[model samples]
Target: MSAAALLSPSAPLPYSGAITDVAGIEVGHHTDPRRPTGSTVVIARDGAVAGVDVRGAAPGTRETDLLAPGNFVQQVHAILLAGGSAWGLAAADGVVRWLEERGVGLDVRFGRLPIVPGAVLFDLPMGDARIRPDAASGYAACDAASTAAPAEGNVGAGAGALVGKLFGVPHAMKGGIGTASVKVGGVTVGALIACNPLGDVVHPDTGELLAGARTDDGTALRDTRRSLLRGDVPRPLLAGTNTTIGVIATDAVLTKVQAQRLATVAHDGLARAINPVHTMSDGDTLFTLATGRVPLGEEAPGMTVLSVMAAEVAAQAVVRAVLAARAVTTAELAIPAARDWPGRRAAA
Candidate 1:
């Protein structure tokens, strides 16, 4: 069975196994195959306390500074994940405008300015470089936003995403959008990710590579970590051609510092699933949002449990991304689907 099919409704959901499983959170995607790129918006419309942790050496982001604990803005209207690298940050403008028109945002003396923090992944080389996500795309994504289960694999920011590029583009595999959630003590925590990285995606439990570099014949998997340990030098391909950006959310109330801590621990999920993560070439970032719906218990262990759950869901979401991805071919690149990979097929 394909990865998308395997995670069907019949599949077990510890929680809803989706980001939308969290109440008051809506997600939407705007995909343009012609541009072969797109954008995704996560609406915290009622406003949610948010924090970010950027681990990638190279990143493209907008308005993240405002999300800091010391910043004046205490909440954000939405979060955007898009393709087109730095150029894609423009998509946030549409999201800001969407909130503004709806009368949502921080109230100032004259008007309200919605706080929209966003990040971008490198997908320009996968398609026509000139064609990228724009303000219109962001607006459309918001318009299509829904509380229903999000469409995964080859959608939104991951539409043009390719993974395991430590070797080169030709050896990389298709990556996409994925989501998973877990419920604990009536509090639901969920994660949504766009997987486009420079290293291999691995199954956390078994340590099996789910997606990454392939053999020259494209018939087998290559251990990206193994190659690096062997001192096999990699050719300098397109640097900064990768990033994995995601958001983890919960209904549990948390302080800004705790939210930031959640984002920090969540990187453990990225490290568990991807070999050579947070490299200079990748912009691996994670954001945490708390809706303040559920009261966190008055104990340090409660935060620890939330952090552990966050990492678990993040890793699971990354695996789902590759599993759901379909192959993509462009003039400059051809990325194989994870389902077709020999290792993945055998494991399935």
Candidate 2:
């Protein structure tokens, strides 16, 4: 069979979409303005088959090993994406408690254990480092869950996120949340991302710089990738300064291996939009959740189709995130909004 046929037994991939397009999947966010850090929760109340891929050199993740194809668990109750770097992992505890209260999770002889896998990106520098996401933040996110389209840009894990830090904070731009989906045959694949890469964001199709480090005047875009190619290196970013975390959801039935493949391809989307992605400063990670609502009948599109669509959707979501991001200014810092770019609004 040809590659496309192996990927999916269907026609081609179609329009941008949302993760909620997958039935039974819900999303929620809780932003903590104190530290400007918060949590985002994706819940599969009925539980969903899940897999994960962590590519960045400095990832901060929880419970990912169990997601391997050979692990015992086959389904996950929820996935947590949050700010506050390693400290944000505490948010998963709240998610677990919420699931337990609702009687969701895998059955242990003693009590039901909610299977929650999570990842975090650094945002401490943007807000109060002393104040970070906690268990309460996770619980609050769960209470706020809804099937409606999730709020994007500077919410949840995206709050306090920054990009284009290669040239330092004065040149970096605000990064935030973005979502997109597409239809491949009868299957629907969607992606949601919290963008905060260490490099610049680029347009995949045109190779145009979308967002990233700005010129000294902070009125124009700077090409970090080109600078790197020319050996124009900047000082090292601080530890835990970047990451981009996201989730991929689909209505198609897939095995753990297939789900893993889907996540692996999703990173291609990130790479397309973010220059120098998966860097030592970034903890880039993606997770895939299959609701198993659609069966693989004859001529049914399979993993390959989902993978292709996922990569595109992911790339699109990255652009959407930077596009939707608002400027962040304090007495100490002033990150320009995408719209604030010279002639950016006019072009848009």
Candidate 3:
């Protein structure tokens, strides 16, 4: 997916430009300058929330099983996002400790729900080698959660993101946090993603590819599919190499089960946006949250259309992620001649 000319943009929002869902859904991030790593979370009203889904082969997920249908937590005190790869699971401990200090989680007979659902992506090995995320960092991330709007593009867990590194970290694009929202039928369906896909991201409507793996032809820029078609690719195993994890935040009221179902449907949004997605090399996952704030009138025409519109928002987000990405320090993916990427800054 080579960057194309500033082709035409995708279709505009089908509804009036106003996000009616996810009221007071706050976000926060803690960046440890010691390394190019961090964490993020979408805070619900008072952190009392629900629902999640795990759809990645090599996912380092948390609280997913607890989010099951039969048994669940009424309110989720907090959500944690962090770096550290699978080992970063330690970060959850920080969240637990933080929440416990504040007295949150399930009030089960044996104990509480401890329902601090979370997700992670691959940024290690390719990120700042000297600086690694740890428990303290995780606590800081969760402690910082508030009405502060989250930062996008190369921050948080995505601070160290590098794309198109099929063969290695070199010849990869700079991918990080990206977000796009749509308001339909007086309801808002917004998407936030930390893009680190193995495949190339493309412009859905214009059909002009945005960003992909590159060759080390002095420019260090090459087309992902074309190179693979030519039989010039990387090794077979690439863990934590490709994944774009995210969650669709909505104020639409849906049961925990219903929210999980929406998460499954939301993956379709990813499929329509990214090329060669959901590969074994990719740990692609999506989590949906129905805050039950927007008194959505059942599957009213407004909310139903919101679902479809969410798909479009997700696709556009992938495009934005590619453009927001910067050049990688990885020697292999570096392009001596290439300046800034094309079709960039064509944003709203």
lDDT: which candidate is best?
1
Clashing residue pairs in all predictions, respectively, total 0, 4, 10
For candidate 2, lDDT tens digit of each residue in 141-166? 99999988888778998988888898
- Stretches of candidate 3 off by over 4 Å are 1-21, 45-49, 108-114, 127-130, 218-221, 229-231, 298-303, 328-339, 342-348
Query: Which of the two candidates, 1 or 3, achieves a greater TM-score against the reference?
Result: 1
In model 2, pairs of residues that clash are 7-304, 7-305, 17-180, 17-181
Worst 10 residues of 1 by lDDT: 7-16
After best superposition, candidate 1 residue 164: deviation in angstroms? 0.4
Local accuracy of candidate 1 as per-residue lDDT tens digits, 1-348:
333345343343233389988887999999986966899999998999999999999988888888788878888889999999999999999999998999988888689888899999998878789989999999999999999889888899889888888877888899998999998888888999999999999888778677898766676677888887879778696556799999999998888888889999999999999998999999898998998888877532388899999999999999888878888888777677777544442211
- Lowest lDDT 10-mer window, candidate 3? 11-20
lDDT of each: 0.86, 0.84, 0.62
TM-score of model 2 relative to the true fold? Answer: 0.92
Clashing pairs in 1: none
lDDT ranking, best first: 1, 2, 3
Please report how far candidate 1 places residue 8 from its true position, in Å.
11
Candidate 3 lDDT (Cα, 0 to 1)? 0.62
